[model samples]
Target: MTPTHETPTTPPPSGPVASAEDVELLAALGYEQRFDRKVSLWGNFALGFVYLSPLVGVLSLFAVGLSTAGGPSVFWIVLIGLGQLLVALVFGEIVSQFPLAGGLYQWARRLWNGRYAWFTAWTYICCITIGITSTALFSSDFVASLFGGTAQHPGVASTPLQRLLIAVAVTAVCLVCNSFGTRVLALISKIGLAAELIGIVLVGLYLLLFQRRNPVSIFFHGSSASHPGSYFAAFVAASLVGLFLYYGFEACGEIAEEVPNPARSIPKAMQLTVVVGGLAALLAFAGYALAAPDLEAVLTGSDTNPIPAILQSSVGTVGTKLILLVALTSFIAGVMSQQAAASRIVFSFARDEMFPGARIFSRVTSRYRVPRNALLAVNVAPLLIFVFVYFSPDSLVRIAAFQVLAGYAAFQMVVLAALRMRLKGWRPAGAWSLGRYGFAVNVAALVYGVLAMILLAAPTGDPNASFADRWIALIGFLVVSAVGLVYLLTAKPDRKSTAPEGDALEIAQRLRDRAASAASAERSEA
Candidate 1:
């Protein structure tokens, strides 16, 4: 099948492209370095940081965490941060080797086969598509509050229809910001990083130092430890708080072609996102929990969303609005970054002719040196889902609940594939590597993934809850997986494309051959 506009088969004649090593490595991994390599190590870290968007994660889930595990909830960030870092370490090795676009999908295909990759990519596309939709929709509350539509519901829309309209505008703005190029994406990341630092770190510090009503002791033992189900159950019930905070790290590698030294830069960025972002989130949670005027109300779930109240009390009305502004930008950043990552996956699929409209979506426009069609395509589905968003006003939290679990399922698919290859004596051969520690890290990452999935998918044990609320993650995952299966069987897209599929050793061999060929050409030119 022909691409509607040809995807660049070689770097352009009269412009900057990826570094010589980056170009060779990308060639080895079965893609042209079409995107201009503009993302520095800091920019890469910024993308992961903003995409992880600590303020958005902590603020969105803080009340729920407080309600569930009380003071002990803060520790989950540390616990899950450590677990996700293990996953990132394993990812660091794989991405350092392949450094391909589409992150998890590209790694899975190269480590295993195109069929496995097909399902993996399909699952990932669905997960991220749903994931960003929820994010964009969730931002509506902030948007509504800024406009002074309803005082009774401070940070939420007065009606579902109002929310749908607000959310549509947010998604539209994000898409417009995304279309400019990688530089814009990097700039947005930096902006988001600044906003987050202020929103989480600065706000948390002030709250902890000056406005604390309760002592620091509550972080160790909040009042809810003595519930009927016990502290362990409460801890497990509130697991989503930690799961949500550490996610944006893997996004560092999604645009591998856009960074100069992806193999090294991306791993560092992923690790930093988990570590720095984790600490920031912990501080924010602690500050808010300690500063709450009615701590018992938050713990008992009477104050369902206590963040605005906490901010207003401690920082006053103007300060609260300023923080809300920061939170709004963080939300926008999360949606934009997620959309950018998903578009790369879309482009990768289309480049392989694995997507339905490969002819169109595969094209990287010559002007911006980015995948223009694929980026636009990312928002099209989410636009349609606004109808559903209008009906389910709390759709953001609901879908977020499911995607975190589904996200783990997608992440573990690559980890499992890598582990299988490792068992067969294949080792990572990226510019950055885990060395002798690679296999150990891979094993540990898989263990963490499995544990996280179990914890995330476990029932919340609220009998009054609807069946969908209790089992949403499991049900949503099964439905998405089933749909992908039907398409894989019917469409059989993987068989039609000749994209490379092999174990890591085979991939490494391709890298060596490509590097040698590129070097030979340079020597001849010299």
Candidate 2:
């Protein structure tokens, strides 16, 4: 007689809530399904766009860029846009292979080792958390301006305290939304993306067609600066405007686990996000620059926000406010996406037992299929830093931007590491890849990333600028990494514990056992 019974089956690891193909992919990577796979390709694309948030980055920083190097400085926007496309290509290859949550962190861990992954996650977490607070603060100022808050009317203008209150309020709403899980976040991001696209098209066309000041000259000329390298300095300073715009496209990669066929969708979504967002940003920035009635006057004037000033002149106050109201959704969407990506990263690190409270932060809620504790960790840490916004408000944006650039530089290093692995005969195992061209693309990404980092490191050419301001990126980089080192040395989490072996044969055995058990059950019932 054939065997009366078979060994107990593991039931195919239930609750994956994904197609068998997706489940197998995760299992091959040595992870069980922990998140609900609800986000679609467009949803992934939307999150990436929202993270870029052209309205927020372009509008808030346009005035600063103009002041730094006149109207022509918008050239940096286009240049950096091209450079970042190279970076995104390399990122696409990495995510295609890993397609894990914590995006950069997970990629580093898999590509190199646990130590590299720890520091990568640490830097990213710091950069994004600070970004959330600063972006919130930036949005609160715009919101305040919507209601007669201007330096022209000191008494009516929103005070620092009020701005802080609003910033905190915005952050709280983002936290609550994130707690609802990926489905809610995806819906909100899609709607926000629609609003952003509409605003970009309408506002850009209006400024370009009706309000062209000197469209042709705006691209070629660099205005007078006080120093010898002032033109170069101005260009460097303005590069931040574009640098800020290009990042956050990686946000899609951070939530890869929440998508089906992530290897295919995530990489495509990232590239498309960069391409679409880059065009939209270039148009928006160029439109504002071309539309400026008197670029020099606006740059030198006492108006704290020259973009709005230009907008007010071109379109009436009501029209400007209407545009701003739509832009506010971008800000809100940014916060939602930022929190989601950051929390996913935290969940990835914690699941690997890297942190002290690893087990806590790693726990996934069954209802939402989200990392509840990780969400709390990501938001609460940033709330503390938001308090600093009250005291040194001017430094917040600069510091946040610098931190992000530093993180990106380090992030590029991971791409270089992948290239090193490729040289050692590593082959692509993912659904998407650069084929034989991967090495060239990877090298280009490194070249672009290194040059961008050097440009970013250059000072603003202000002799009077504070030491902290001059080296803010380096300072932030050291502090974040130092803290990470301390924790890493002290805690010394076991690498093997968090580093799950990717044993395809082991997973296959489990599947076979489950299939055998199912067959035996049918025979008994028959």
**Residues 411-501 of candidate 1: C-alpha lDDT, one tens digit per residue:** 9999999999999988677767888998988889899999999988876657677988878888888888899999999989998887778
Q: Candidate 2 on 174-277: residue-level lDDT in tens?
A: 88888888999999999889978877878888999999886567677776343345576666677777877788888999998899999899888988888898
lDDT (Cα) of model 2: 0.76
Worst-scoring 10-residue span by lDDT in model 1: 1-10
Candidate 1, residue 282: how far the Cα is off, in Å: 0.4
Model 1: per-residue Cα lDDT at residue 188: 89
Error of 1 at 517 (Å): 12
Which has the greatest TM-score?
A: 1
**Count of residue pairs whose backbone atoms collide, per candidate:** 2, 0
**What is the Å distance of residue 468 in model 1 from its true position?**
3.0
Clashes of 1: 2
